[model samples]
Target chain A: MPKEVAIIGVGYAGFRALTPEVSYKELMYEAAVKAYEDAGVDPRRDIESFVTVAEDFTEGTSIFDEYVPDQLGAVLKPVHTISGEGLHGFIAAYLQVLTGAMDIVAVEAHSKASNILTPDEIMAFAMDPVYNRPLRANPHFIAGLEMNRYLCETGTTREQCALVVAKNKHNALYNPLAAYGASIAVEDVLESEMVSYPLSRLDMSPRADGAIVMVLAARERAEELSDIPIWIRGVGWCNDSFSLENRDWTNAIYAARAAEMAYRMAGIRTPWQELDFAEIDDTFSYKELQHMEALRLCRPGEAGLLVEDGATEIGGEFPVNPSGGSLGMGHLLDASGLARLLEVVLQLRGEAGQHQLSDVETGLAFGWRGLPTTSGAAVILSN
Target chain B: MALLEKVDKNIEARAWQGEIPIQSRYTCGLAGEKFFREIMENGRFAGTHCAECEYTYVPPTIYCERCFAKLDEWVEVGPEGTVQSFTVLLVAPDGTPLEEPDILALIQLDGADSVLVHRLGKVGLDELAIGMRVKAVFKPKKEREGSILDIVHFVPVNA
Candidate 1:
C-alpha cells in the first residue's frame, strides 16, 4: 500500500455573491496565509510542491498558472496547475505525497466567479466548437436536459428536486461563510423563473467568490504537524464521455466510477453505511439527488425520497452537505469541491462551528466539472 | 501580507477592462470532414462504424471511443431520429430572455448507437416528448455550407 496522506491544515477566504474589493490574487494570498499559519509551516521552507486548479477561459487569461506562484508563496518553487475541479487538484497533491516525491504539498483553488461577466458564454465556449457551440444555446440547457432525463428515468419529481434547494439553503443559515442561505420553501424554488425547462433560477447554485488552500502531508509528518489531521482515506477521479450524446444522462457515471475507485481504496463496500455524511455537488437542485444516487449514498430514485424525508439534513441520519453545499454557500466554480472538502475537514476536527454534526467520524466530498463535461472527482476522509 | 494591507476608504483601485482580440478557424477533422460533406452535398447523415464494439458513432470520429478501433466503416444513419432528451431555453447565452423560447433536443439518429444535439423545430414545448420521431429539415442546396447547421432543424415526423 502507498503511504497515507492527511490534510494537516485548511483555510479559506470569502464565500460571497460578490467580492469587488478583493482581486483573485488577493483571495489566494489571504487563503494561503491562513493555511500556512494553520499548518505552522513556512511555505518557502517547508512545502515542497504547490498545485492550483483553474481554467484559462474561466480566468479570462491564457496560461493561468503563470499568475498563481506569487500569491501562493510558491515563487521560485515547484508548482503546477490542474485545469480541473479543485478536488482533482487535491487528489494530485495527495498522489504527490503518496509517491514520496514530496512530504508536504499545498493545494489551492478559488472562484473569483464574481469577476466573470460573460459566465454563460464562457460555459458555451467549452462545448464542441463544430457540433454544439454553433447552436449558441445557453450551456445550462445541458443541465436542464439532464435534469429532465434524471427525473423521468428515476421517477424523481420536480418538487423533490426543489426540496434539495430548500434543504440546502436552509442548512446554510447556520454557516457564517454561506452567502445564499435562506429559509425558503420548496414552492419558492418551484415558482422561481425558469431558465430552462424544469430548471428554475433558484434551483441553480448562484455564483460566489472564494479561495481555499489545504496542506497535505505524509502520515508521519501529518502526525507531527497537526493536532487534528484528517486522513485522506481515498481519492479517485474519472472522466466520462466528452460527447454529450454518448453519456448516461440519468446517472452521473463519472461520479459513480470515481466513487467506486475511492471506495475500493478506502475499503468501503457500503458507502451509505460506512460514511457519516457527504458534501457532494449540488450545482443544480436535481444534481444533489443525482449525485446522491451516483455516490451510492442511497439507491437510485431513493435519493429524492431521502431529501423529502429530511434524512439528509444536518441533524438527520447520514446528514449530507451540512456546510450548506454550493446551493447554500453559492457555487464557487472550480473551487466548489475544495469548499466541500474544507467543510469535511472542519467537521472532522470538530471545528465546524454552528452546523457541526455530532459523533461524525468519516465524510465524503465529490465534485463535478459542471456542464459540457463529464469529469468528476471524489475523496473520502476520516479522522 | 504587506501587499494585502487595507487601502484607505477613499482610494479607488485603478483597473482597466478590456477584451482580448482573438481569431481562429477550426478544421473539421478526418471524420467531421466526411460527416459534414455528406450533409452538405447529399443532405444525409453518416457515422463511423466500429466492428469490434458493434457500435456506430454519430458525428463520427476516426477512432472508436470504446475499444480504440480505427473506424474505417461508414454507415448512413438518419435524417430521422427519436428524441432522447430535450429542453426549452428561456434565456440566451448572454442571460437575456429570448423573445421566443427555443427547444433543443438530443436525437438518437436511427441506425446509430449515439445521439446528436440539435434544435427542435415546429413543436411546442407542451407537445414535445422523449422517443418522439423527428426528421431533419435541411436548408436549400445552394446554401448548404458543409456544417452541422446544414440541417436547419429537426421537425416532428408523422407519428
Candidate 2:
C-alpha cells in the first residue's frame, strides 16, 4: 500500500505583473513566512526537506537552485530543484512523503518575469538549433499557427477565443492580486494589436512576478498538524511528443493522459460532475479552451460554448480558475501550477472568500509547460 | 581566417588584451558528436548514408540513434537547397524591439534527410516562400573553415 500525503499548509506572496520595489529574495521570503505560519511549523524544525521549482533561463541566472536557501529559511537542510514548474515540484514532494522518505516536505515555485529584458530570445533559444531556430520566429508565431489550426480543426471562432480573454479577465476583477483583471470585451481582445497573426496581444498571458508555496505531510503528520487537511488523492504528470511539426496542433494529448492517470489513481470515473471545482492554467486564451477539452471538462471544441453558456462561471456546474488563472494572475512559469494548487487547497478549506463556491470537497488543478512539449500535471485535492 | 585583421584595433596600446568571444553550444547525438570533430577541422560538409535506414544527413552525424545501427558511409550535402520555413524577427527575448528585421531560415541541404537552420542573405519578407530554393555562399576562400559561419548565408538561387 502507498503511503498517503496531504497538504497541511499553503502560502502565496505575489500576483504582481511587475515587482520592482523589493528584491527577489525578499519577495520569496514574504510567502515563506506565510507558508510557515499556515503550516504551523518552522522550516528549521518541523519541515524535513525543501523542493523548489525553478529554471535557469527564466531568471537569466545559471544554477539558480543555489539562491533558494537564503530566502526560504531552509538553511542546512535537504534541498532539491525540480527544474520545471510548481506542480512538477509538487509531485516530487508528494512522492517523497508517499515513499515514507520524510514526514513533512515543502514545495515552492516562483517567477520574476518582469525583471527579464528579453523573454522571446530565451524562448527562441529553446528551439531546435538546426531546424527551428533558423526561422527566427517569435514563439508566439507558433501559438498563432497552432491557434489557426485549432480553429480549423475545432470550428471555433476568434470570437470564442476573445470571449475566453474577456471572461477570465472579468473574473480577475474580483481577485485582489489579479494583475490583468479588467472590464475587457470580446471585441476589445479581437481588436488588440496582432502580435502573431490570428493571435492578438490579449491571447497570451502577461509575464509577472509571484511566489507560491505548499507544505505536504504524511497522513499521520497531516492529521496531527491541522483540523483541515486537504489530502492529495492523486498526483500525475506526463509528456507527449516533442517535435512541434509532427504534433496534432489541435489536441493536448499530454493533458488528457495526465488527467486520465490522476483520475484513475483517485478512482474518479466521471470528472465533469464528480470533481467540485478546478483551476486550469490559461496561459493563452485558446489554451484554456484546448485544455478544457483535454481535461474532458467539456468535449473537444465544446469549451467555447461552455463558456458562453455560463456553465463554468463561479456558481455554475464547474467554476474554473476562481483565482483568475494565468490570465488574471499573470504567467509566473513554474509558479503558475502551484498557484492553481493553492486555489484548490484554499477553496477546499473554505478560505476562498469572494470566489467561494458551494459544497466544495474535491478540487482539480492542471498545469501545462512550454517547449510545445504537451507536458502537464494533474492533482486531486479533497478534504 | 583572420577575423582580427578586419577590426583594425591596435592591441599594443591597450592596458588589457582584447577579447573576441566566440562561445557557442552544439547539440550532440550519436551522429552529431562524431560529426563535430570533422566540422571543426576541414570546411567540408558531410553526412551519414545508412544502408539499412537509407537516412542521409548533412554535416554528418554518427550511428543512427533512431534505427540503432552503426552508420559509416558519408554523403556530401550540395551547396544548394530549398527553404522549409523562414521568419523575420522583430523583437529580442528581453522584449527589446529591433530596429531592423533579421531573416532566419531553415534550409534542407540537398541530399540530406533533415534541414539545418542558418541565416538568409539579402532577402525581404515579401520575396520569400516556403519552397524557394537557395544556395550557400561561402566566406572568402581564405576564411573558409569548419565553423557554421564558413558559409555566410544561403542566398536566393535565382537571385
Candidate 3:
C-alpha cells in the first residue's frame, strides 16, 4: 500500500486586489516563512522535494520555475513546476510522499494578477490561432456562451444563478482574507452591468494577488511535526478536449470525471452525505452551480435549486464555499485552488474562526483552469 | 532598527514593460488541411466521421474521441445551422464599446456533432435565440483565404 500523505502546515500572504509594495518573490517568501514556522521544519533541512504551480503566459516569463527556488529556500533541491493550478501542485507533492521517495514536501502557488497589464490578451494568446483567436472578442465571452448553454440544458434560471453571487459575497463578510466581500441582494446582482449576455459584472471573480505555500509529509513525519494534520484522502485531475468546439459546454465533464476518480479512491459512495462542505470554482457565479452538479453533490439541474433553498449556505446542509470562494475572496489565478484547499484545512482543524462550519470532519475542494480550457482537479480531505 | 527607514521616493516604486519577443507558427496538420481545403475550394464545410463510433466531428479531427479509431471519412456538414448559444459583447477586449455591440454565437451545424463559434450579423439581440436557424455567409469567391473568416459571419436564414 502507498504511504498516506498529510498537510501539516499551510501559510498565505496578500489576499488583495494589488500588492505593488512587494514583488512576487517577496510575496512567496512571506508565505514560505509562515509555512516553515507553522510546520516547525526548515526547507533547507527537512523538505526533500518542492513543487511550484504556475503558468508562463500568466507570469509573462519563460521558464518561470528557475526563479522559484530561492524564495521558498528550495535551492539545489528537487524542484519542479506544474503548468496548471495549485491543486495540481498539491497532488504532485502528495504523489512524491506516497512513493516514499520523499518524507517531506513543500508545495507553493501564487498569483500576481495585477502585474499583467492585459490579462485578457494573455488568455487570447492561449486560444486556437486559426479558429478562436482571430475573432478578437473578450476572452470572457467563452464563459458567457457556456453559461447560456448550462442554464438552458439544466433548466436553471438567471435568478437562481444570481443567488450564488449574493450568498458567496455575504459569506465573505466574515472572512478576513476575502477581498471582494459584500452583503448584496440578488436584485443587485441582476442590476450589475452586463459584460456578456447571461453574465453580468457581479457574476465574475475579480483578480487578486496572493501566495500560498503548504507543507506535506508522509504520515510518520506529519505526526512528529503537528498534532493536527489534515490528511489528503484522495486526489484526481482530468483534462477534456483541447479544442473548444469539441467540449461539453453544458456540463463540466472534466470536473465530473476527476470527481469520479477521487470519489472512488476516497471510498466515498455518496458524496453529498459523506463530504461536509465544498470549495468549488466560482470564477463565474453560474460555475458554482455547474460544478456542484458536476461533482455530484447534487443531481443534474438540482444545484441551482439547492442554492435557492439555502442548502449551500454556511448553516445549510451542504455548506458550500464558506470561505467565500473565488467569487468573494478574489481569484488568485493558479493559486485559486490552494486557497480553497487552505480553507478546508482550517475548517477541518477548527482553526477557521468566524466562517467555521459546525462539526466538519471531511471536505472537498475543486479548481478549473479558467475559460476556453476544459481541465479541472478535485481533492478530498479529512481531519 | 526598522526596515526601510532610509528608503527614498525613487527607490520605492518602479515599473517596466516586459515583452516576450517571439513569433509562433501553428500548422493545422492532416485533418485541418482537408477540412479547410474543402471550405476554400468548394465553399462547403467538411467533418471527419468515425464509422465505428458513429461520431462526426466538426473542425474535423484526425482520430475519433471515443473509439480512438482513425477518421478517414470526410462528410459535408452545413452551410446552415442552429444557434446553440450566444452572447452580446458590449465592449471589446480593450474594454471599449464598438459603435454596435457584437453578437457572437455557437452555431451547431446541421450534420456535425460539435458547434462552431462565430459572430452573428444582420440580426439584433432581441431576434437571436437558441435553436434559431442561421446560415453561414461566405465572402465572395475571390476574397476567400481558406480561413474561418472566409465565412464573413452567420446570419438569420430569412435575412
Task: Return the TM-score for each candidate structure.
Answer: 0.98, 0.78, 0.97
Candidate 2 recovers a fraction of native contacts equal to: 0.10
Name the regions of candidate 2 deviating beyond 4 angstroms: A1-3, A245-248, B1-22, B27-159
Identify the CAPRI category of the predicted complex in candidate 3. Answer: medium
How much is the lDDT of residue A264 in candidate 3?
88
Top-scoring candidate (lDDT): 1
Residues B1-159, candidate 1: write the lDDT tens digits.
424464445355545575656677889999999999998889999999999999999989999989987989999999899998899999999999998998999999999888999999988777998889999999999999988889899999973
Q: If you assessed candidate 2 against the hidden native complex, which CAPRI class would it receive?
A: incorrect
Candidate 1 collision pairs:
none
How many angstroms is residue A249 displaced in model 1 relative to the true structure, after the best TM-score fit? Answer: 1.8
Query: Highest DockQ among the candidates is held by which one?
Result: 1
What is the lDDT of every predicted structure here? 0.91, 0.77, 0.90
In candidate 3, which residue pairs get closer than 3 Å at backbone N, Cα or C atoms, i.e. clash? none
* TM-score head-to-head 1 vs 2, winner: 1
Candidate 1 lDDT over A1-383, as tens digits, reads 24389999888998998776678998889999999989988999999999999999888899999999998889999999999999999999999999899999999999988778889988998888889888889998998899888888999999999989988998999999999999998889899999998899999999999999999999999889988888999889999888877877778999999999999999999999999999999999999899999999999999999998889999888898998899999999999999999999999999889898999888999999887889999999999
